[model samples]
Target: MKIVAVFNYLLSFLIAYWNTESVAEDEFIYGQFPSYFRWGIGTSSYQVEGAWNLDGKGENIWDNFTHSTPSPIKDGSTGDFACDSYHKYEEDSKLVKSIGVDFYRFSISWSRILPLGTKEKVNQAGIDYYNNLINSLIHHEITPVISIHHWDLPMPLQNKGGWTNEEMIEHFGDFARILYANFGDRVKQWFTFNEAWVICVMGYGDGIFAPGVKEITETPYTCIHTILKAHAQAYRIYDLEFRDEQQGQVGITIDSGWLEPSDPNKLEDIEASERALQFKFGMFASPIVFGKYPDIVRKSVDERSKQEGRSTSRLPSFDKYWTDYIKGSYDFIGLNHYSSYLVTSASSDPGPGWYGDQNAVTFQDPSWPETGSTWLRPVPWGFRKVLNWIKNTFNNPPLIVTENGYSDLPDVGLNDYGRIEYYKGYINNLLKAVIIDGCNVRGYSAWSLMDNFEWASGYTERFGLHWVNFTDPSRERIPKESVKYLRKVFLSNGFPKPTLPWNSIQLNEQCAAVALDPDTSF
Candidate 1:
């Protein structure tokens, strides 16, 4: 019943927003996908490059965590040799070009760029590897969308108390500047950090990921402050320093799933859902987009801190410069969305519950389909709802989806029908937003270009449109059935036939043709 209502609400919202005639033509009709539009697929350094301690690369939190604590990962496996894209990137770039994307979005490993987490000494190899990747992408006519940080923090920085320490803001900004000076000319789209919620909350709040620290009340809040501060500082540096020369745009990507209160009319449940909103979405969005923490966040955390007898809200404060620094930081908004959750306030008091989800909120929906990656559930309507929420909340800044894809269990085959289904549904919802809702959403990047490390879940969950053979030294990439379909969507500028059960389209031949000559996607 709850799921039905949420779907009904989303469908009606689409109906109000949609106008099929305007976007009914080919996908390319949107003006070379807007001069700002980017069709990209991404891979993070730690997740794909897999050269933890080689050629002067410094240690990072992931390096230490994966090596120091094995069992914390699902299969007790590390990313020591995952994908090995560092050595075989030429081949990988060839694959990316084959897919006919306009851009390649990959993160620079912080430890690789600044081994000591400082500019005192630059790692030549680290710079060279990325330079090669960037040059290769450009050589093949693919633009580069670079992320300055993506979960991999230099171990030295972590040892110095990481995000908990105030100094991190300036240090991270300096690092961003260095990249700005070096590659900003070629890489027009720069992302300061991937998603802070996963970094601070999941990693700090729950200790499930790297830099693993389980300090919910204190740590997560403090970490949020540092991440935002760092992002703001980075954005300011890039905006001031490189914007004129490189003429690029910068923004931080945030993760937010749609929330449906078990009962929207019920105040407590609604408030609980909103709190979850302020927690999951607001955790990062409030600071970046709104320039301050949400009211619910500050109040709730303040009261909690008072109960704990803390000096003040664990959430840090910035001086006037920072207040100004953090405001208007984004050139555009980058969002990674998947699934939706049903939020019902937990039992009132005096009961045990899920760690992060204590009397907090419960996420369940009988209608949503689960993924091999247990953290995800298929909820297509949620994508449109969340995108709309972002537009309304941020007054509709230009939006781009940095990451979105389905994950499957290891046993899933190369020809994944479920993956195809997931893409069609979410993308159809996305088209609904662009056509009906008139969202300024300009670009989309598949979650991953290749199968790489999946953090704590290890290699158990696969989200790549192209499968990576872990045992193969070459890490051979095989295009999944979904990849072809996605290319067609990209080629079409997301125009769709007015229909339901939209996952039965075919595109294997197109995939083969596109892969044959990646440089000329058209």
Candidate 2:
């Protein structure tokens, strides 16, 4: 089988790498993760939930984007019937329990809850759907980790300028307040927004995502400023009004990646790497950790804006009120990291928008193995590097790794040996960060539970531990070897005792024998 061979190759590589690397003397014992370390799986509403127009759910920007005359989605597919999870969450909950995860991290659909994106109109059907999901998870003793916004902004808000409009602060706060009032008692961990960088940079700066507007110029900066304020308001509301009563923790999830300088000895390359980081992670994180934009970002954007004939600095400034409110607002740092980039100082403009705005360029090493997705390349060591960077830069903030996974096209079948290697290397590096480097990571959630609509990629790419047959009207779910692999990791609470060369072909055959069945409840 193709999968068996891939597994063997991956194990051989890992064993060789482990033998050569200089490990710390005081490294935490393998497979001895702390008792409280949480393991979970992640999914987003727009990407997974179908019934897009059913149950009075208001149209979100994604709905509009996918339905546009000239759709940008690669496969010309829309998420209108994605997994039908909106109608079959009971089945989803069971899938989570079967995997032995401690929690399920899923986002709330803003348009589903508030059709008008305002408190004046609450959709009872949307409320009912989520309530049923929460109750089911609770019944199974699986904790619910909620993300308040995950890019499915109500079309009404998009029509009115979305994140770019400062008025969004009140809209988001009110929407968050509604969620807290209803579900705060049961849901203890809350993510105010999922991947602020993707929402701003991909959505506004690059025009590749929903409500597509390519303003690689200053709009992304403005969008993130408003988003940060909105996040602060939601966090503060939960902090002041609900934390004592409900005992829940609130924070935001950021999409950050490790950046390796193209030339370690060159100052220009090192600075370029830092600039890339500042433009992405620091754009949102600085407002939370330092209560302002990074100096590099401010300086670069200001200088570039002036040169481009702008009247003032492109980077927006927060008042003392907002700065104070945004600072120190998180209970934990929720990070969603996937691949790392090799960065170098740009000799010329990289492109329009954020690419050019950063004054740097990123490329991937040809030697690194690629996943099904063109963007994802496995570089496990970078995972530890980024984690250490977070530990030092943010003073060892408590962290929940919200998303990480590999993608392969659906035609690959459910063998998914590549995904197994991806998780193993990244998770092993994560353990090194926590144990040897002393980074304060408390949890890890693989990017998704099953393959669903992958945003712009549509149904072309699969990231789920379990594979879903999109062409099947029943939306059948099938277990991949990664599921069995991860379930073992969950049961062990860390790396398995022998550390995974699982060296025997018989062991690979045993893993390959796991069968797939349709979830009955769906």
Name the candidate that leads on TM-score.
2
Sliding window of 10 residues with minimal summed lDDT for model 2? 513-522
Give the lDDT of residue 156 in candidate 2. Answer: 96
TM-score of each: 0.87, 0.90
Clashing pairs in 1: 17-436, 18-436, 27-492, 27-493, 97-518
Would you list the clashing residue pairs of candidate 2? Answer: 216-353
lDDT string, candidate 1, 1-522, tens digits:
556544544443344334433443223221123345557788888888887788999999888888874368888878888889889888888888877788888999888889999989898888888889999888888888988889998999999999889799889988999888888778888888888888887787788887889877568777878888889888888777778878888888888888766885665565566667667776677666767777666666666556667777566666787777787788887888877888877675422112233345667676678778766888877787677766765677888899998897557868676877787667767766776666799888888887789999788888898898888787888988777777766665553332333343435344333323223243
TM-score of model number 1? 0.87
List the RMSD of every prediction in angstroms. Answer: 6.2, 8.1
Q: Measured by C-alpha RMSD in angstroms, how accurate is candidate 2?
A: 8.1
Give the candidate number with the greatest lDDT: 2
Poorly placed runs, candidate 2 (over 4 Å): 1-29, 350-352, 496-522
